[model samples]
Target: MSEIVFRSRFDNGRRKAFERSPKVSLTSPDFYFSHCFGVCRKKTSMGPPGIIWVASRVTQPDKLSEERFCEWYEGQHIDEVTALSGVPAAARYEAVPMSELAGPPTAETIKAAEQRPDYLMGGKWLTIYEMKDVDFRHTAEFKSLDGQSKPKGNLLDEIFTKAHFETRFGALLSNDDKGIKKGPGKLIISATMTPGSRASAEDIEQFYEREHVAEIAKCPGYVRTRRFRWVDTTVLKEFERLPADPIEPGNSVVALHEFEGPYFPMEGLLKADETPWTARVLESLKKNGIEAGFYRLKRVYGEWLPGSSKL
Candidate 1:
């Protein structure tokens, strides 16, 4: 049997809610077989088939106030995008600051906080648009929103000049729907990564389906976890050209975990990952690295209905 330690950046400041205790090893072959077999029961398809995830940081706040920026985003931009055929829903989120937490800071937490960008630490805002399929990008309605087609002096143009954006398109891989709560949780953990050369996509998928998601589910307030594989965005870039320089490409995979929260359940989450399987998976992906952030839901836009402008 292999001994693999569980370590997380959230483990530093010990809060009663975030503490972990050791558990009996389940690394034996029999346990692995039975656990994997039982947990891998058949299910419906993953999550939404296609999604557009955009994270933004306001670089020139003097030129555009956050209030005005959000007003245009929620009031106008979301309406424009969701009105297109095959696009049904969207939501917005804001990054949560570490200083707002009640506990003392841990070294790891401090380091993580320090690494965040000064503009907003993690991204200041995130918007997610759900599509019926990845092919929605090729539709004429979508193409009409291209840079060449936008009015010269639109609010969107001003937004582009004042904000930096990172966008990703994801195709669903798997979803643990059994644990999902009634509505979107107040907090979301967005984790992006690429599997290292040592691991295959199947390895990552199986690990989440069999162990990782279930473990996280054990934590208090855990809502659901959805995983996605990155879709190439070369074409999207050609369509929606903005004022800012192009952003670097995103990671190959993303996992979104929703949690009901007053604050992040760091202790429960750290303890949840205390398994040999988690250690093994993390080690495999270590070479590629993981980027994760905490964001709180600011607002949610339900499915777009025909002939309705309501967001």
Candidate 2:
């Protein structure tokens, strides 16, 4: 852990506090809410990081507006307080067409998209990014060199080459045809890495350095990226399981990259083409003696908050 450099807009005090204590209270909703509300209010005023909740659609699917969202819960709005408390700045990013999400959607995909915690980083539409950590400055490896000579071209790009890139031929048609709209076709790509026993903080830094990040960013159709440092905690059973008591982090850091192009990148034709790309990338990894990681993918509902100027 060379200092965790967050590419977010959170205030200094909150960032420092989270850095000091990354644990979230699981048992004490009241205490958690108070802290969360304060942070939310502060962020609302100063424009801090907005929290994204990642609840299962099956468990709690009906979407709610901010007012309703607060009403439905027993605890105070943690968004404001947490933002104020140095939990990292908070923001409310609503979906332009959030409700459009549907699926063979499974928990694995949802969990994959939410490489970080669902409580702090989740919300309606399977919250993806809070927009704070848009840069690729988090733990993840995007490259793998197979035993073959590291090719001059990327395996994925090669697979989706113009010659073989037609949808009929099992190529993913480009989203370029649909035109870029607010929430259409944006999917989240989440990668998680649990350091081996000997891994150190410095090792973490080297993993996400510019080289790896740039490659991930350069991946075929990435929209934006969000990286999260799990406040001290491990992977719990679900959002309802934590003790509500502030504690050490048990989970690993999570990095989310949004890929919103005209077509879905990993399905049907796209997936057909990607399979080989993945093989080549993995082979590359084996050759390079690097570890491969498990990844999750999700087609989620994301919206731009009302009156938000950035959309």
Candidate 3:
């Protein structure tokens, strides 16, 4: 087998940190098998290489009004993070209620819509941050800007006390652009899961690449599909005061399907999953390890213009 070597460059300070960290050969089968979902293969059309930080939260509305939370998060917090080096862009999303996802009231559609885990269902807001590299989070600039070590009494400190946050880090695997319009889709459906003991990471990647993604692309408003393999989980220094019980284990894989529309065609999504191959793969995922959510883009920050709010 041909060997593919992975190399990286960093400044002196970062080099020291990188050297101290555990090393893994990117060319090894074990490395590819463990961290990637077949995107490492030469045949695969890989997405823009980098790390994505997905952060979701549910804030106490009674203590801090929704208006206040949105004003602070959208107006202040997002800009602060994006201004940092290595962080290029960010987007925010709001959960779409089940009632608004118009489609046939069939059993299948209803079941599919309601099959999300509690964390996803309860996380009313989500933010996706695009980083230039995986080590960006560990840099001294990030740590200082994070303000975790700073004294309390700031607005962020107050907001953290009133909200429950969950975050996961994933490396980009594949980005399939199928939408007519450029940038992010108005609607996004996120599915996350861990493969069963009998199934391997490659098995799930092949399913999406060969079958599932194509099926969904045939839907009316299909825009693009992006896949990621989980890397790790972290608690923002702000949320450290809260109990850790709410922090859930991260899933092994995540597939995001973006759509352009006033409303997603729930019926079409159900039909796409009716194939026997999809059924077999889904069944092989560990029990209670799968979760999904439907969200509408709310705001765009940094490099991209703001998305439509009409959804």
Structure candidate 3, residue pairs in collision: 179-223
Candidate 2's C-alpha runs over 4 A off are 1-53, 59-125, 128-185, 197-201, 232-251, 262-311
Off by over 4 Å in 1: 1-48, 101-121, 146-151, 198-200, 233-251, 286-288, 304-311
Clash-forming residue pairs, model 1: 18-267, 19-267
Ranking by TM-score: 3, 1, 2
Expressed as tens digits, the lDDT of each residue in 1-311 for candidate 1 is 00000101121233232334333233343332222111122334433476777776666778878887788777867777777766678778888776543245777677676665422324678777777775455444554552313333553446655665556667777666555465567788888756664354457778788888888887778877777766633212112323211211333677888888677788877887788877776676645356677788988786732111111
Give all TM-scores, in the order shown. Answer: 0.69, 0.35, 0.72
In order, the Cα lDDT scores of the candidates are 0.58, 0.30, 0.61
List, residue by residue over 139-216, the lDDT tens digit for candidate 2: 121011120112234421221111110000000101112223334225554343443333443354454553335445
Scored against the true structure, residue 182 in model 3 reaches a CA lDDT of: 69
User: Mind giving the per-residue lDDT tens digits that candidate 3 earns over 125-224?
Assistant: 7777766554454444554443323323565445765665555656677777746776778898878877775354567878998999988998998888
Which candidate's TM-score is highest? 3
Each candidate: how many clashes? 2, 56, 1
Residue 300 displacement (Å), model 1: 1.1
Between 2 and 3, whose TM-score is larger? 3
Sorted on lDDT, best first, the list reads: 3, 1, 2
